[model samples]
Every structure is written in C-alpha cells, then in structure tokens.
Target: MNSCATSFVFLRRSGYAGLLWVLLLSASANTLASPVSGTLSAVGSNTMAGLILRWGEALSQRHPDINLQFQASGSANAPSALITGTTRLGPMSRQMTDTERRAFTQRYGYPPLELKVARDALVVIVHRHNPLAELTRQQVDALFSTTRECGANAAINRWQELPATQDWPFGAIALHGRNSASGTYGLFQQRALCGGEFRPTLSQHPGASAVVAAVGESPGSIGYAGYHHLTPNVKAVSLINAEGQAIALSENSVQSGDYPLSRYLYLYVNAPPEQPLPTAEKALLDLIFSPEGQQIARSAGFVPLSETVRQQQAHW
Candidate 1:
C-alpha cells in the first residue's frame, strides 16, 4: 500500500474507537442517574403522620417508581419497628430514651441516626366559649395533680377556685388527656402533672385531634395537645410561668424557648439505612427539611426549625 493510504486507514480506525468509547460512557452515566424503585416503610408518631402523609403524596409526583408506606401509632412503637427490621425510619415526637437508643445500637451494631424534623408546642386547650383564657403554673399543676382529687372534686372544678380568680366564669372543669402511649401524654405527665397520675375521671383520648375535639365539644372542658392540633372550636390557654407571666404558645415563642411547653420532634433512622431508601422516601425526607418543607410544617401549625437545625436534619 502507498504510505499516505496506510496512514489514513490508521487515523480513521482511531477516530472510530474514540467515538465508541464516548457512547459507552454516556450509556453508563444514564443508567446510574436513572431513578431506583423500592418500598420504604416507616412507623410511629401519630402526631406527625398527617404531615408526613402529605409530603409523601407530593413526593410520589416526582418519584413514581418509589413506594412509601407509613404507620402512625405511639412514638414508642417506632424504635421497635426499626430494630425488628420492619421499618427503615421511625417518626417520634420526643427524643428517644437512653434505653431505646441503646437497644437499637446493640441490634444494628450502630446507633440510629437522629434527625430533628420540627418543633412542637404542647398547649393547654379549653372550649372556645370558656371565659378563662389562662392558667397559672400552680393552677395547672393543681388541676392535674391527683393529690387534690381535682378531677373528681366538684368544689375545685370551677374557674373561681384557681388562684387570682374571684369573679371569673364558673363551671365544672371537665378534663381530657391522651392515652398512656401518646408522647404528648408523657410530656404532660412529666411537665404539668409533676409525674403524678391523672385522675380516673380525666377522659382518655387516643390522639391529639380527639383530645381537641372532646374539649371543643364539651362546655368548660379543658385538655392539652400539640399546637398543630388546635382548632377554632378550641382556644389555646396562656400558661403562667414561674415568673408569673402568662405566655401564649406560638412558633416564635416556642423556637425562642419562651414557650414553656415546646418540645422537639425527631426522625430515627436505622444507621446507614439497612436497605437503600427508595428515591421517593429520601426525597420526601429531604423536603421535610427544605425551605418549602418547613413552610408546610408551619402551615400545619407546628414550629419550623431554625436554618441550623434544618441543615442538620437534612444530612440524616
């Protein structure tokens, strides 16, 4: 062959090989970038279930291949589900107890990743028609403390029985509280009831909405629930602090630590995610910490976290 002809043939072969390599790399990248399909299961925290469900609905629009399922029960059940391998994530309204955290670590060989999803204010609620708008810390304690039989005693039921109230509206103080499994119930018992048992007469409801509904439907009824659960039929009562100042619960007040009843909300994930989280599950959790997600939290009546907290939650 002529020298020029041989050189042209070699150059053409090299150009063709380079084009083939480019095509192969592009195909591999496309496969890696494609969406993954799988089911992600989470359980616990009925208080947060509604918000999470809404997020899931929105997430499905963007990630049709991923399947997400959630079960709302008591916060205590979540960690159990994780340890048993029944769920990848657990939603909890309160921080995990030391015992529970230890159990998860022992079973999984690593501690579960903890994420703070939002802030919640535990508010005292009364019937909208009730004239009493606030209660002193002492008065709140007195009402819930079994030491006084406030629940069963008619004498102490009236608003007038409360300190600093002589001419306030008078009526029986019907009490509504959550079931033992509820996180709000635990918090109320520790903070307001002073670890005292609730009165036998105190009505036990299953969830926050039920508690709020019970209080709202009954005249002179009082109860407590997360601020997000409060409705127009029920009014949130200001709590008198140790300083004797009445403080109303609000996102600003709760985030600032001025609201005495405010508490943290958490998401507990098995460390390293036993199985990879479906794209939809990861995206939904990401949205919960995103600016848009925080707005949804706020709209749901919970306190959104600060930017610092949001960033920390995003990593988990």
Candidate 2:
C-alpha cells in the first residue's frame, strides 16, 4: 500500500510540471503577438506636409500606442538632421546630390535607404484672369533670365514681347518664387530655368502657399509650385516643348515619362532603425507601398509608383 501511494505521488508531481511548462509557453506566445511600442520622428519637405499629415492621422487611428511626430521645414535641412541623428526619417522633394550622399555615408558608415513615396509635377501658375493658355520652354526661360531685352529691370516689361501675342495682357509680369533653400526652387532652377540664375525682380516667398497666394492676387503675376497646391484663382499653364507640342501634367503622362517637369518625392531613412520603430511606423511604411497607399497618393495629386518600383521597395 505504501509503494502504491509513492507511485501515485510521483505521477501527480510529473503532471504538474508538464502543465507548468505548457502555461509558460502560452505566455511567451502571447507576448510575441503584442505590438511593438516606440516613437517615430520625421522632418523636412514642406511640399509633402499635407499628404504626410493625413497619413499620420490615419496611422494613429489604427495604432493608439505609437507616437508619430513631424515637422515641415525646408528640404535642405533634412539630410543634415539625418546625419546628426536628430531625426529617423527625412522627406525630400528633390534627389540628393552626390556630394551630399557621400558626406552622409561617411558620417553614418552606411548609405541611406531611399524610398520613393510619390511624384509631383512642377506647375507654372498664373492669375486666373490671364488669357495665356500655354508657354514654350524658351519663352518661360526668357521670362526669368537677365539679358539686354528680357532682363528683370529692362524697360520692355510687357507680356506682348513673348512669341504668342494676339491677345496678350499689357502689363509687367511679376514673378514670385520660393526662397533659395527650397527643394522646389532647386528643381525649378535645374528643370525650368535650365540652370540659369533667377532675375533680380523675382520675389522670394516664404513657402509654396505664399507663392500661390501672391500669384493669385496679382493679375500679371506668375509662380511655380507642386500641382497639388494649384488653386481655383490660379491657372496652370501647359508646357510646350521646342517642337510646339503642348504637354499637360498628369499621372499618366508622368508615369510614361512624357512629363518633363515631373520629379520623384523621397523618404530617406537610416539603413537600420537606430531607435526601434513602433510596429505602426513599420506598418505605415509598408502600407505606403501597398495598393491602398498608392490610391491615396494618386488622390492627393501625386503620381503612384509602378508595380516594378513597388516590388523593388518591398525588399527595403
């Protein structure tokens, strides 16, 4: 009878140990299923402020535990912030220069992970009341260049001097542009002005919105900005090439490489997260390459990437 009791006691203890092991394993699995927690900070690209703000709001709704903060300063400050470890993500409207890329890699010991988020067309806007419907590349260049006849300070300041003048407005053309530090300014200098310097009379506005507002209020004024900011009071002029073909800016044209003024919008990140990114941050970026995110990008007046680009970004 004593030996039987010993055997029963052993069996009971063995069963208890097995149940404890099972309980521990279940707890571990539950912990793994929980979402990661942390904060994500991003800066730069005032041009992308509206879209990202909307994205952040949506992301926060799905992830109540994670914090996402953003700032809409000039794009030139983004790379600097990244190199100095002040921000984890940097949004830019223009591509990085070779010198800037080399400096960043030297400081961080790795190249940045660049993700193309959207595409924007550089839109030339004029007052809504203006009758000019299109502008040739040369004519646009002449308006911003300084020379004997077309300089900013020249006395022949009327729009009638341009090529198409049947119903031209008889007034001086006032120009408004972003400050030198703006990514839009850099893009305009390279693509529209053909690397030529801006004229003296070109007024420097604080931001793209200001440029749009200034142009909208002035009858003979002109300005350029991302197509997303075009207002009803401002008319977007069609760009004509040297061959006299008018090209409208649209997602179809931009994706087909037919829009000469379209440029990629980028989100620059560290090679690996220096500080742990919340699950929501990772998921938000993942969704950006998803079909749903692409749809949002299109609706916001930006071009979505092709399937090929989306596949390449999946690995990043």
Q: Which lDDT values do the candidates have, in the order given?
A: 0.77, 0.76
Where in model 1 is the C-alpha error above 4 Å? 1-34, 148-156, 163-165, 273-281
TM-score of 2: 0.80
Model 1 — which ten-residue stretch has the worst lDDT?
A: 147-156
Residue 188 local lDDT, model 1: 89
In angstroms, the error of model 1 at 142 is 0.5
What would the TM-scores of all predictions be? 0.80, 0.80
Best by lDDT: 1
Error of 1 at 211 (Å): 2.5
Q: For candidate 2, which ten residues in a row score worst on lDDT?
A: 147-156
Writing each residue's lDDT as its tens digit, candidate 2 over 1-316 gives 4764565567568787556555555655554665644677888888888777766766665554556688888788789888889987898888877887888999978788888887788889888888777877767777765542322233334677755544665567888888887788888887887777778898998778799999999887888888788889999888886566898766677765577688888999876546554466586787678787777787776888878887788667
Q: Write the per-residue lDDT of candidate 1 for residues 1-316, one digit (tens) a residue.
A: 2763565567568787556555555655654675655677789988888777766665665455556788997788998999999987898988899999899889978888888888888898888877677876656766766663223233256666765445556556788988876778888888776676777778898778899999999866788888888889998888877797888877678887678888888988775646675565667787788898888788777788988878877876
